[model samples]
Target: MAEGGQIDTDILSDEAFDVLCSMCKNQGKNTEGEQYCVDCKDYFCVSCVKVHSKVPLCAGHKVLDKSQIKSRTSKGLPRAPTERCDRHSHKHIDMYCQKHDTVGCSTCMAVDHRLCKDTFYIPEFIQNNTYQVVATREIQTKLKALDTILAEKADRFKQDKQRLLKRKAEILADIRKFRQEINDHLDKLEKSSINEIEDKVKSLEDKIKDSLKQLQANKSRITSINDKLTSTNTNQSEVFVYVKMAEDAATVAYKYIDDSELQCTTEDIEYQPDITIPTQLEEKKTLGTLAKKHTKTSVSLFQI
Candidate 1:
């Protein structure tokens, strides 16, 4: 009876190991795992190893003996046969939620799939032979499709990144070009304004110099007339003529001075900048509006 119990335990262990072995599980075969493939991260029975060795894809795979597996296990490495939940690392995945079309742990079932209508214990679900056939076909098909989608998405992402980088460079170039255009325009305007100011100053200076020359000439004439009037040898008629000439010269000088004062009035030049340019620039948030265009393309994978 004790030997029979031992036999039964070994059979159960073999069955459990087969469940964890990719080769045995997929082939729907019952086999006791004897070796571990390091590269594949899977256990293989003697028969499975023979099959694995025959496959060209398994050429470089490294296999370890039971002793090595035991040694690794002793060093805290988990022995293959138990599939752990990705979300709950401490818990094993043993339940399936059909509604969500996902396999998860007991904790996942309790926390996430509690309200799901079609949840099942995986071990019990797998007892139905139809489940294996359907799962194998559908899962394999979906996995292949997902792989294709992933590859396409990766390519698209690369293309998009390149396109965006190119667009960014173009935008920066355009902005710099626009700024250069503005600088060029401002430089031209500055040169023109400076020339205008210089012309105005030159004109004003010329008028003041001309007025000064005239005033000086009038002063000289008046001085000469006064000197003639003071002469002792001059007669009364001559003196009266000299005095009249002096009065007329003084009147002309005063009138010229009054006229010159109006013409040579000291005034400063001032510049008023247009407030709108800077005010609008400060209020502006962006150079231009960024817009998104939606385009749709349909893809058919594994149509047949």
Candidate 2:
């Protein structure tokens, strides 16, 4: 098991080790893994190793003691059976054919790949194609750079959305404040015009009240003269004098009331509420974009 309790496929399990040793089980008394036959790609018990060494064909095969066998895999790849070919049963894959981009055994090289332009032993091929290994590492580097670029762009986009939302709130607040200022200014103008109209009307009302009071006093004087003349208790000359004085006062007061300019109208000083958003805030553009491209390369793993 791995660190997280997940099964690690690269390590050989007990059951798999038992299965590999089964090939030598018939010849062995003690069936416990003690050695690995590299050529046969199998595990062998102690008795099985003695028998395998005696055979002429198996004698040439490479053997490893259990303690000498490496357990961990390389580059996360399971320990590949490099001693045998996948296509040919028990045949060793020692030749690499550059023309076909594949590794094959002796029979495969003699038949289908005899006319191939370039061929070499697997060890020589790997030694000669170090450039291909470098190229693969370069590709990994490029991909890692792309990962960083994508992560940064994603973070920038997230920040852009957040910033735009915050800026919208700020602009809304400014607009509301401007609207309130406009309303307040209009309120001030309306109140001033209304006060002026009220003052004009009040002044005209006071003047009218004063004129009525004077007319009432003149009527009282005229009535007093009539009562004296009818009762024969006053002189006719004094009654004529009272009538003349009342007539002069009446004509002047009536003319002044009719001629005085005491009217007020809101048509000249009416307040209006009209506001338009300024030019800078009216722009319609939202945001921008970025573009990236990938190019093809002419390189092959088999080419050195």
Candidate 3:
């Protein structure tokens, strides 16, 4: 079995022979190129290619490049058990099973999916039911707009509250200053009235002191005359004591005047600013449900 007068065993040993055979099996030397088909286990040149299939035993299989075959096979291989039909493990659930109200693969449609109708591809189903999706999206947009408006309104409320408080403090300060001026005016009026009454009382006291001194002098003169008459003991000698008494009564009256009762009047002052607070709109529960439903639909579409 030597091609060049050397025994074939010299080039290939028992271990090396198996390795070479495996390499030939994988590469398919007769067909050419590095890639090979899984079903045919044969390599083919670019010009000699035919078709491939996503699901085996179906009409037209996807044509694949020789170089990309390995990557494709790796990607398409199944791992754990999926919702896809067991009969056709390679085919994913791609259509709605109307009988079960669920999605299923092609095999389920043909077999276990009983009495199923209105089956459609995932894309086709989404395309047909677009109105629901559009309505849901509109609700989500409105919710977002409401949230933004609420944020702005809250900021404005804070600013307005701060401004109003500042104005109120200023008004209170003005009121306090006005009150102080009124008190000062009352104090000055009362002080002037008290000083005038004190001056009048001092003048009356001086006049009463002079009248007492005059009465004391008259009493001394009368006593001296009586002593002379008693010492002389002569009836013919005339010793005369002259006394003049006039009853006179005069009343001094003091009247007090209150400054507040006189000419003082207060004017009512009122400060009012036009203020309007926005009423909070009631949150519609239906919109929230619509938003959530649309979010789920979007996630499902992304997965597809």
Candidate 4:
């Protein structure tokens, strides 16, 4: 309820006041509130109040009609149930087992308290005993404490969620950094290998080119000697001298050709990569393992 655009907390205790029937509103109906159930913490229409009165659990609950609601002061603001069963999350607290001195939902009576001979409906039990102001105050105090504990837990859980998200982002970044580092190292190794191959091939090419030049020089000298011997104007002594020079040249060329044989052979260069690198990588299941440590806060479970 609001007055002058401000909530009237005194009239409704710590809760926001609603004039509509909560039960009807849940069923998608808009009905005016006729009565308020202090135990259920809900407003109800005339029809719903009748149902509430008939229920063994809610029959004896403290209620206020519309006239009483308007006249009641802040001194005795009603205390009501939060209305959920602790064990059966979907069920509501609606029964009391006097034999075990326990209260729970109807399911609890059916399963665990069926054998108890002293069981009584929650409202019937309340009706049998005189209502005490101390009991209502005690219940209100517990509700306030529970609300505080739940609020703290909610805040902590939200903080933990944010922390987990941040941790995940950091881990992902580290993985990408590791991958980039490996790629850089491999790139350097590849460049060095290429340089080494080029250097060796260039050295071998220079040696082969030098050997070919010497062989060509020897062939030219032999051809010049043959031309001198075939000429009709050349004397016999000159021909003999030229033939002798050719024989000396042939012996030197033969020795050079034998020494250069391996250098002049056709060759193909190839690179053999280290297979162990890839093999080890394939054998690995992960870059690293992810782990977590958790600490649970002790909290007393709320019961109806």
Candidate achieving the largest lDDT: 4
Q: How close is candidate 1 to the true structure, as a TM-score?
A: 0.32
- Tens-digit lDDT string for candidate 4 (1-304): 2111121233332333446898899999999887877567688999999988899988557566665454333523323223456577655454556555455666667778766666544433443445454433343343334334434433443444444334434444444445454544344444444455446445544544554456556555545544544552223223323333445555565565556544433332333334343335544434433222323432211100
Worst 10 residues of 3 by lDDT: 245-254
Per-residue lDDT of candidate 1, residues 171-203 (tens digit): 444444444444343444344444544454455
Poorly placed runs, candidate 3 (over 4 Å): 1-131, 184-304
Error of 2 at 217 (Å): 99
Give the TM-scores of the predictions, in the order they appear: 0.32, 0.24, 0.20, 0.32
Name the candidate, 1 or 2, with the larger lDDT value: 1
Q: So what's the TM-score on candidate 3?
A: 0.20
Error of 4 at 193 (Å): 29
Error of 4 at 282 (Å): 6.3
The lDDT-based order of candidates, best leading, equals 4, 1, 2, 3
lDDT score, candidate 4, position 188: 43
Off by over 4 Å in 2: 1-131, 182-304
What local lDDT does model 3 show for residue 71? 28
38: Cα error in model 3, Å: 43
* Cα error of candidate 1 at position 236, Å: 99
